[model samples]
Target chain A: MHIRVENLTHIYNQGTPLERTALHEVNLEIEAGERIGLVGPTGSGKSTLVQHLAGLLQPTTGRVLLAGTPIHSKGATARSLRLQVGLAFQYPEDQIFEQSVFREVAFGPRNLGLDETEVKARVHWALEMVGLDPARIGPRMPFTLSGGERRRVALASILAMRPRVLILDEPTAGQDPQGRRALWEKVGQWQQETGMTLIIVSHALEELARLVERVIALRAGRVVADGPTREVLSDARLLRDIGLDVPEPVALLQALRQAGKDVRTDRLLPAEAAAEIASAWGLRRAGA
Target chain B: MKAIPIGMYVPGDSILHRLDPRVKMGVTLVLMTIPFAIHSPWSYLTLSAFIATLVLLAGVPPRTLWRTLRTVFGIAFLMFFLYLFTTPGEPLLAVGPIALTWQGVLAAGGQIYRLCLLVITASLLTFTTSPMQLTHGLEAMLSPLERVRLPVRELAMVLTIALRFVPTLQEEIDKLAKAQRARGADFTGGPLRRARNLVPIFVPIFVSAFRRADELATAMDARGFRSTPHRTRMRRLHLGYRDLLAMLIVLGLVLTLIGLG
Candidate 1:
């Protein structure tokens, strides 16, 4: 489903002394099959804004429409919206509680009142999608697993619901380099195969550059920038203003460009920069 | 739910804050016992005066006292009403279906006074002494019971962990509630329905709490927290001249109250 947010605003503890405005009048749209990256510093309201996409939070002032229907409209049930938008919370491992991994992953589907056979199939498929062998890992204690393994299992628990729009909040947080790369590849492939709308929130600019086609930058509960990945990320001044560090390669390319080198600062990822540099040198060699 | 800050000790350089927690604990124990011995109006007045003096010395604001008193106000009110009706003596006044007597007034006053003093003293200890120091004092006080394998250290450790995580779990609950509400879960239903609605929340909370407990256990194990008979203290409790003087003053007050009774 295409997620539509219109002038969304949310304030926590509305009348109390600790009241905080977590989201401003934000407007954005996620087209079907588009991979969107959400980048912001801590307390920038990226999480609050995305939580609205799944109808997990009601906008205090505006509205969120999923598939052109107002999710906060009267009679709209969270259970139905939850099925359409799967949210993998930060530190999702804390949400795992069942005796075994199988039961934990099966929780969402079961809550939806799916048939036993269907629940089992989704559980098996989700475990496999995250690259965990269901037979080997299904019965193991989730609490005893390694951190990376537990994170994948947590993601599997959400994936089992087969949400059309997958929202992962820092999916690669606390993972080693290898684990981070592997999980991104798996998620990217899954999005491509299923054409699911993917929204990933992360502080790691380099990691987000690898998976998303578009980037939405948030600062102080407002959207500072929302556009194509190359366009948003190439604006180093804006990124820095919002407290986000540019990806190393992007920063390096921008520096080289400032030094009058023929380098494309638009290339945000390391691989993209490397490929562009090699092609440029290849052209020079041909001319020579 | 923001952390309620119960049992939180704000570290300061004030005299009460600087006192050894063992000394505070001992004084608190003595004060708690004196209330039980109060049987007359004069003795209750003496106990109230002692509490008021301590409250002033501790420098706790009136707001803190009110917040602590609010928790036990219902019980205090109940005891007041019970004693007013039940105590027998020469009638002082009578209203429709209610008789007021000197004995009844004294009984009600005494009960209310005792309840107020108990709560105030407990609050003073908790407010002035950090949970870490309180737990240490408890471990020291219960050291003799260790011979009977009572697990004093383990119990203290558990208390410390619980105190540390109350704020964490409260923050988690707030986050989860916001998350669920964003998903359209209704929490504003009527009492019974609202109670039932807490299942989804309670499930996640209990899950997370257990997860935290497991992580804490692993961290503690990695730090070599084993059941050992010997451990050195970073700050040992010693009875300084000031503590001795404070203890003697408390003992004298207790004696005076008993003599008045």
Candidate 2:
């Protein structure tokens, strides 16, 4: 579904002394099948905005439109919006409750009023999409799995719903490098197979750089920057001024350029940075 | 959910807030028993007025107290009707087949008033005293029972921890509920279906609660927490003139109430 958020503002604990404006006059739009990365420092209202998109939170000021329909109007439309927009929350495993992984992943599809066979098929497809061996992992207890497996199962649970728009908040948060890579690969494959619109919120710049084509940065409840990934991630001074770390590959290339090497600092991924550095060094040596 | 103010404690700088919690605890206990001892309408009126004054003096918002009492109104009104129809007394009015008695109406009014007073007074105690102070007060008040081999200190500690975790668990439940709701878990169904839907939400809460408890245990152990007789407190409880004055006022009121009853 195409998503549009117009002048959205969210104030937590409104009318109370502890009321806090978590988001302030935020405006953004996402076309169907767009892959966008949402990055921000802690408390930048990234999660709040994402929650609004899924209709989990009502906006304090403005409205969120899903396919030209306002989602805040609660009823059948809200239920359909929830099915259309899947939110894989940060630390999603913390809310995992089903006994077996299969049942856990099947919960969302079952709630969609699908038949048992369809539910089973979705579960199996989701598990396979997340790179988990369905036959081996399906019947195992969810709580018994390792942290990474649990995280994958949580993602699979959301994936089973086959939401048209998937919003993953910190999807790769505490995983090791291998786990992160594997999960991202699965997510990429899933996105390719389904053509779903994806919005990923993360602190990992490298992953965001490699995965999403567009980047949006938020600071203190306001959108600070929104542009192509390379344009946003390569701006070290801007990100550093906001107390956010630029992606490591971007930082490395910029550091080399600052040290008097005629290198391209706009490269965001490690492979791109490596190729840029090799060609820059070779050109410099030949000229000398 | 965000609009509802769930907690009772309202921070303030009042005489009740400053009074030693042990003395406050004693006063509260004595005041709670007044509803039972006071039988006459005049005495109940005096006690109710006294509790209302205490609530005001503590700087507690009347709305906060009423928010709690509002939930009991249906039950209280039901009890009033139950007494009106069933109690054996002189009938004052007739509604078709049911005879409403004057004595039954009076009895129900007294019962409901007494209950409101009880709940208000209890809510006042919680609103004025912090959970930590309540814990210390309970520990100090029940210390004498320690000589009888009771685990008074441990019990108080448990109370304190449980009180502390109430807000934490509430937040966890809220998050889990939202997450479940986002996954198409509809709670607006029949009672049976709602109950069935809640299983996914609650199981995770229980699991996380256990995990949190384990972490809390480890954290407490790291801080060298242990139940012992020789433990020292960071804030010592002492009875001052204000406490004595408050106690004297409650004592006089209680005596007058009993005499009138």
Candidate 3:
């Protein structure tokens, strides 16, 4: 579903001594089937903004429209909006409470009042999507799994809900390099297969550069940049000013261009940059 | 998620903030006795003036005091109303089914005054003292309990950890609630439905709390924390002239209130 936030503002602990304004008149439009990356430093209100997509947080002033429906309206129900938008929180493995992985993955389907057969099918399908063999992992206690395994189980739990819009906050955090790559690959495949709108919040610009077509940069609760991934990553000054490290390849491409080389700086990922460099230098690989 | 406000002792360089926590504890104890000694309105007024002067000298914001008062306002009102109606005395005023008496007013007013003084004094102590200082003071006060094998050190350690994790747990709960709400879990249904809805929230909260406790235990073990009887502190607390003067003033106040009563 298309999500639009207009002049959204959120003030926490209003009228208290610890009152804080987390989001300030933020405006953004997300189209359906679009892969968007939300990039920001800690405490930049990225989490606060994304929580509004699923109606988990009510806007203090403005409004959020999901599929042309204002989610904060009098008739709006967060429960119905939630079915259309799934949010997997940071370190979601900590939320696991069931005895086994199967039951844990089935929790969402059960909550949705699905039949037994359909719930089982969803659990199995979700586990397979995350590259975990249901037969091998289903009966295992969730608490006994390794960190990466638990993370995948957490993702599978949300996937069982089959939301049209998926929001993941740092889905690959605290994972080994191999695990991170595998998780992202699965996420990419899921998005493609289901054609769901995906929003991933992370500090890893390089990883986001590989998956999302567009990036939204936030600094102190306000949108600083919103555009194509390549365009956003190539803007070195803007990225550095917001405390985000531009992707290595993008930075290198910028440096090469500044040194009077005829190199394109818009390529963000390493593979894309390598291809551009080969064509620029007119070099032919042995395999090609 | 907002950090738990426990141990959120605001950092300040005021005289009250700098006072030794042990002295503060002693003075709080002494001040608590004045309410017991108060019989007439004059004694209560004297105690109220003393407390107000101390609060003013501490330089705490009036907003902070009101916030603390608001927390117990309901209970204070309930106690006052209960005593006003239930106490036996000569009737002073009658309104519909309710009858107010002279003795009832005195009793209710005294109870309310005592309740307010207790809450405000405790809040003042917490406002001026950091958790670390409070824990240190507790340990010192309970040191003699070590002879009875009460695990005083371990208890203090547990308290310190619990205080430290209050904000973390609150943040976790907030995050879990949002996460659940994002998955079609409604917590605003009818009474029965709402109670049922809490299943998802409480399950996650309990799971995370246990997980956090385990992680904290591991972290403490990794940091070489052990149950040792003799351990050195990074910061030691000492009582100075300010503590002595404060203690003497509190003692004098208590004595005068008792003598008048």
Give DockQ per model, in order: 0.15, 0.69, 0.48
Task: Please give the ranking of all candidate structures by TM-score, highest first, separated by commas.
Answer: 2, 3, 1
**Mind giving the per-residue lDDT tens digits that candidate 2 earns over B1-261?**
544453467778998889998888788788878788767778977887887788778877666777878977899989888877877778888778788888888888877877787777777777788989988898888889989989998999899899899888888888888888778888877899889988988899889888889999999999998888488778888888998898889889978987897
lDDT of each: 0.82, 0.86, 0.85
Highest lDDT, which number? 2
Model 1 agreement with the true structure over A32-78: per-residue lDDT tens digits: 98999998889999888877887766678999888888876666363
Please list, in the order the candidates appear, how each scores on TM-score for chain B only. Answer: 0.89, 0.92, 0.90
- Better lDDT candidate (1, 2): 2
**lDDT over C-alpha atoms for residue A274 of model 2:** 78
List ranges where model 2 is wrong by over 4 Å: A252-264, A277-288, B1-7, B39-45, B95-97, B222-224, B258-261
Candidate 1 per-residue C-alpha lDDT over B1-261 given as tens digits, one digit per residue, 9 for 90 to 100: 432354456455567887888999989988898889767778877878878888888887676578788888899898998999878888898886678889999889878877888888988898889888999899889989989989998898788888788778878887766544433346886999898767657887987777688998999889988867577888998778888888888889888887998
Per-residue lDDT tens digits for candidate 3, residues B1-261, read 442253247657788898989889878887887688668777888899999987887777777777778888899889999999988878889887788989999899889879989988887888888888899899999999999989999999999988888777778777777777665566786999998777767887887678789998999889998897488888888778988888888878888887777
* Model 1 chain B poorest 10 in a row by lDDT: B1-10
Per-residue accuracy of model 2 over A193-215 as CA lDDT, tens digit each: 99999999988888887789899
Task: State residue A166's C-alpha deviation in candidate 2, in Å.
Answer: 0.7
Q: What is the lDDT of residue A213 in candidate 3?
A: 95
Model 2: DockQ vs. true structure: 0.69
